[model samples]
Target: MPETTYSSDASGQGTNGSRFNRIAMALFGRQRDKLQDPFYLLLLLGFISQGFFWENTVVPIMLAALWFLLIHLSSRKYAINETTEILFLLLALLISIHFGRTAFMRSLSFGNGLLVLQAMRMLRPLTPREKCLSAGIAIVNIAVGSQMMLEYGFILVLAAALVLILQTFHKLEAESCGFHESKFSPRAKWKEFSFVVLAMIIFFLVFPRYRALSSVTTNLSIGRNAPIAPTLDPASGGMEGTGRLIFQISGDDIGYLKTFTLDTFDGTRWAAGKHASAFKRNLRVEPKPELKYRKAIVKEIALLGGSLPADGYPVALKGNFFQDDYVSWQGSIRVSRYWPADNNIYEYWTDLNKHLDADSRETASCLKHPELSDRAKKMIADTTAAAAGEYNKARALEKHLRDTFTYELGTYDLNRLNPLDDFLFNEKRGHCERFASALVLLFRQMGIPSRIAIGFVPVEKNEIGGFFNIRDTHAHAWVEAYLPDRGWLVFDATPVSDRVLQRPASGFALTMRDWVEFIWYQKIVGFTSNDQVMLYKFTAEGIDVAAEKVSRNSGIMILLTILLLALTGGIVIFRRYSAGKAGRSSSITYSEIFAEHFYRDLLRELASAGIRRVPSETPGEILRRASIKIPSAASEITFITDEFCKIRYGGRKPEEDLHDKVKSSLHAVKSAIKSRKTFATDLH
Candidate 1:
């Protein structure tokens, strides 16, 4: 007997040839002695964690040490190739270098080190275990890399690289076994993968996204301004040369447009200054006073992807307004240093001057106080108190403004040092901003506590939602006068003809895409989890939370969750079942079993004629039952027919192994019948 070098057990196939044994012996190489698993484990840990621990050099250095150990261990399995050599050098460079310009860049460098480790493992002669470890490292790298902002181009390249690695390792495995058969052909498999991706997209879109599952708030600093203090030179000349207008405001209330609050005036240009004594985190403006016969003008304001221009005080504002989440307030709205532009929506109704009456004088007076600005105090004192001649003087001043000053956009320029002073005296032709500024200043001159209110007018009617489409062109400004009992009344001086608030005909200002996006944000993406739950309940059983939660604990919520889970489970089970059934072979019918039994007996009766057939075959399968020689055998062949009748038509259970017995008898009958017929023919 040949000497068997390799032994095989019941568990798996064994190689016995001397040459095969030599190949298997190559697995335990000398390099394996120096390698350690901790290096790989550390890499995995760095990939999973975040923050200061990972951001600082501690985690990264630990990961590098781990990589060194794993490489040392891998030496025992496979010899290092040129690729692995380069990877070793790259690791040294990465660990020694520091790239701290950005968090994203730092993460990229760290991820690169992990990739190098994996690539080196793949280049060296790797066993199955080594291959698995490298693959796992690659997976961890991908998982960590997902947290970084990888560009679209890089994502495609990474996907291709992973596929190539998988295919290469699979080929290597097959080559080692001397077998090269692919489990699935590439052509059909890609189509299946595409369908899977499509199904995933559908699932994401339909799944109920629970918002409360994560308490971490999304810190979107897109529009937040940097906290760095800007440098200003007092002697650097006031205006930096006027250029083309950046924005334009036109409306019945577009008077005295204030684009910014500059309280930090350092003797030259007004800058961001300290907050007012009463400034609060979230200031709510008081609604204007309502009076009988007051003319009502609805103003629509838009923030054309820029900052809000207001005096550091807005006590109350109402409209469909969405402030950037990152917008902070050092007493007022502070645009993010990073992202400085955003669009905003504003709309509201204010009590017109027509609401004012003689009896409301005391109410208006009560609203005014002495600690107010000189301009406002003067304006109020001149307008109110009919006992003095100041009331007539205020009326005369108001009439002059209503009859004079032509309305136009861009009447003021960057060259104008005092925009308010220029509009009132030099430039008789001014826009809404100029008109409103003049009115407020005049009221202040009369000793009345009045402030300029900026807004817009003639709000656009959105064709899709029947809501208002307020835009930058609707930016407007007006005067708010405090009344004793009426609070504040909004008064506009700009003529209505100058206003431009409706959608423009050019189609450039308000495009269809913008409208669609607005609808998407307002309806779908903005729907909170609470909204989803309410909607689900409304669709399912017409229940609302307020009516039930106050009453008692309702098991309906629990039952609904369970029912949903069961429905999901049932779908999964049915899909798996259907998939299994699709792979099955030819099905059996009840009639086919009976036919097999009937044919088996006929073949058994022909046994003496040297004819034979299997019991599982049909009647049409037998053709050699013509050589039977005995007369008794011919009678026996007739008996086989009776047996077939009982089993096929009687519906009674056959005897144990009855089909085998019937097949034998049928073969004997065939030989007997054939022998008698063939002998008789020969004699003739």
Candidate 2:
């Protein structure tokens, strides 16, 4: 039986016999001592997650991580001499070059090229510089991802990568200066980390954001779903679809673009009724839909404020024209002044739910109206009598109207005194307005409070825009009946035209993917100088008011604090520099640099003992192989390798005496090798 002795490599791999074990160890690693293997794992995880989150394919990152892991953990397993080693290096170089070419082309927008560079740099036998380079690559990768990532999950990924990357940089910092530690304490590392993070935040916040780069990159129409925000209330049916593109609305929650509501119908026309509350300018809608709301960035050509077209209930409004905008009690957004007719851009947030649901319905009995003709009254009576519930009555009325009347866009006989009566009995045809108006009247006759809502039914979806496209012709009218506890419930009595197409609401999967997507893009990358100015103005008002109240001495205190911080930072740097001065005698030897020297000497000494070391075998593996011939030196070899690896790769500096201790152990191994050869000669 061959007695085998094992040792650890600085890169965290151990010796294993046979080709399979060698490959396995190299690929997975046996590193329980250092963070290199774990950091690589975390780095690979970031790559995989980002690849999946971004449009980049995960398979390439997967393969790259596998290759890097194999090389990283096994670099010490093979020396520069072997043919296998040569082939591995050659193949790695070719793949890296290929990645460099492809990743550079794709990385600026949304590619995993920097990750490949990071993996390449992390492969074993790393200098402090290479590790720092890899860490920098990680930071760059995160910054790039933030620009394109829409999902909220990216925050978690960023948090993890930030932690791992900081640790990696911290390890490198320790390796660089651990020879004589003056003050690289935990507090100092945290301060450095805080400064790095603070600097990034300052750069992001202080810089005037221009759309030059993001405008081109952000509008990337590649493999993207409808990003903006998720809808809270979605319906199965809407008005007949049309595609003239009156408004290009970007948001997760958009269905019907309601312009205004009409509570008064005079048979001649439906008009907006007076309310107890007048229109008022406000910052945000109180009692907003929990967290579910749409931040719609609307780009409307030839649209302005008599009644601003808002999708759902307007929660908040922001734009040049919207500063003086007033929202009516009936959910009408209107600006007191004229807005630009062309290329008008504005942003607003609206409630996600189209209808407020508190649950439980209340029914109203049919009421007699003297103004309505007998024929009109008869139809309303029949609709109320046949229907059971409030919703069923509405549904029955809808079905009756849809079945009886043909949807015609052309004008009907409106010269008559009672146009509602004429449309129901004689003409039996009109557009959405006529149908909706009659339905509202009929519902009112049934003692149900109802109103006419004017808006464009978003049946026309633009796939290119990933949002509903609203045109002038897509303007629709629908009736909303009041239900107790459950607020206004929408009921469309207009017949569905074949021209009407249904736009599917975003699925749960897509909803999750675009959860915070539009908000993030708009608030971050899509934020313009105008937005910055608005933010600054809003912030400065409070700051200026506070400054007025602040004592003059308080300002001086703040200045002094800044100066004090700078002085402390300077002192820390000076102490760090002074630690390496000539007058000071350090206790640490930095023996890691001499690890290869001792390793090479061991290989030479073993070769002289009639056991030639192979390039394919690492120092640990060579010692194990030689221990079979000279088993007496097995413990001494393991001890020496342990000390060497801990100092070289583990970022643990060696004490002054530790170098002498390793040399003494190496001498014992040489003596054992000499005795083994002598015993072999005596046996011969």
Candidate 3:
């Protein structure tokens, strides 16, 4: 026996961190990957999916990952206590209360709270049965998170989760069958997933979307959540925000969607005015014409803060949402209550034609601080001096600002007593905010009713879906001046000079992303029972149309069909024939292998008795040699050799007597040798 010594290079990663990592991996890492790796990844993905609507997702995902790591790395001596269950109960209660109190926070408080609970359950060690239960919990977490918000993100997350979930079960099945270190093939994975995906697609097509459990495509765009209100403050925000799609507009009324008008200037920023109707101010509500002069625009939009923008006169705006939940305030639409999460495809007769009534003239004219700097007041008066009436005066002021002021997105001083004065007098370069603010103030001084309107101006229409993809960069501010003779007229004072124009947002990557989102929204999230019926109809109609077309060209179609069938039959026959040919050759069966094992053992036993057989020696030669070396055991050797030859080369099958015959022959040989030794010792 020798004591072996082993040494390797030290230093580098082989230090404490590496040592700990090695120890950790040896003790607690993937153990041949029996579903734990995929399960853990699935857990994290389930939490991450909620990030679309839930703000508290990152913390839960972090907590789950940290706790998972610690639990696996340690000995995991702990178990789930009654206290843990009680904590989960208390959390659920609090979440229910929060949901009741803040109804719109469905995805935020409740969805994230459930995920955190699932994460906390992983604090203890998990047995096989417990692991199965944990998998069920993960499913719940995924379902909870997914149902709260259905977006393109959730679709992606669910796709990944599906793969992981299927892998986890596959591993479990392998482990059950004693194949602990099962090697999963990527090809097999896709093959298995195809069946599941096909099943899911069929289910989605067949199942009617129940109103009680319908999901919503939430407004998760950062562009949608940006601070949209006007603030004349020196905010250090980016010049242009992210290019994420806020929403999309598909119709001809694809111009500016007025959200709200900034009525009063608190000097630093313009505050949104109270919700008031055109009728409240003694204004006539324009009826929707029987024939829309401008073609009807149907829009599918998702926005935050209950703001669903409708264009033009808001008298005849029709949508799939509750009429009671929405209100047309000052030509803008606002969802007064929680969204119904029901059918929608909102239609607007919006022509981008804005009009204000005589009743709003006085309200729009009033301002908080009309006293501008002396220079600004003088310049504005001189600019409008040639204007005859209110309409001319307002146009004159708008033209003056649009012509003279340079459009630049620059931060303005919030604390300045008069930002309008700064823009007009010192720095004439400003964005639409400044230009629109300057015009509004000048109109107020001239005894004209004007207010700043902040909304979006869509410029690029998607070439794929033919919809206007609105991003935060499309946000604009302009002025709406009231005229007693005509109506409220639109005016934008932001000059087009020196502004960076964006290239058409059309590329392979962008087109694909938009296309995926469009499908998710239109075909997936917004899918209804009606949609299901329509899908069936569409499928049936498509088949019928295709069949009709083929019938019209029956001669060519029959020839093509026959060729296709022959080709398919030939391919199938070829594959089967190839498989059969490959399988024809074979090896020894289990019984033959057993017989060979016995023959080899017989030779080894004789060699151990000091009658070693040469590798080249045949079984018969070896048996004879062994008998000659010990002549007393000649008959016993003869019987054993005959039996082995019969089975090994004579094509005899193993039988019940095979074991007994070999055992008895070997015993008889050993007895003969012992008897011979005794007799020879006596004679000596």
| Most lDDT-accurate candidate | 3
Residue-level lDDT of model 3, residues 323-400, one tens digit each, is 333443455555443334433444444444444564544464344455777787788779888988778877888888
TM-score of 3: 0.51
Q: State the C-alpha lDDT per candidate.
A: 0.42, 0.57, 0.60
TM-score of 1: 0.39
lDDT measured at residue 681 in model 2 versus the true structure, 0 to 100: 96
After superposition, the stretches of candidate 2 with alpha carbons farther than 4 Å from their true spots are 1-46, 49-124, 177-184, 207-435, 439-453, 456-528, 550-684
Candidate 1 weakest ten by summed lDDT: 291-300
Each model's TM-score? 0.39, 0.40, 0.51
Error of 1 at 503 (Å): 5.3
Better of 1 and 2 by lDDT: 2
lDDT-better candidate, 1 vs 3: 3
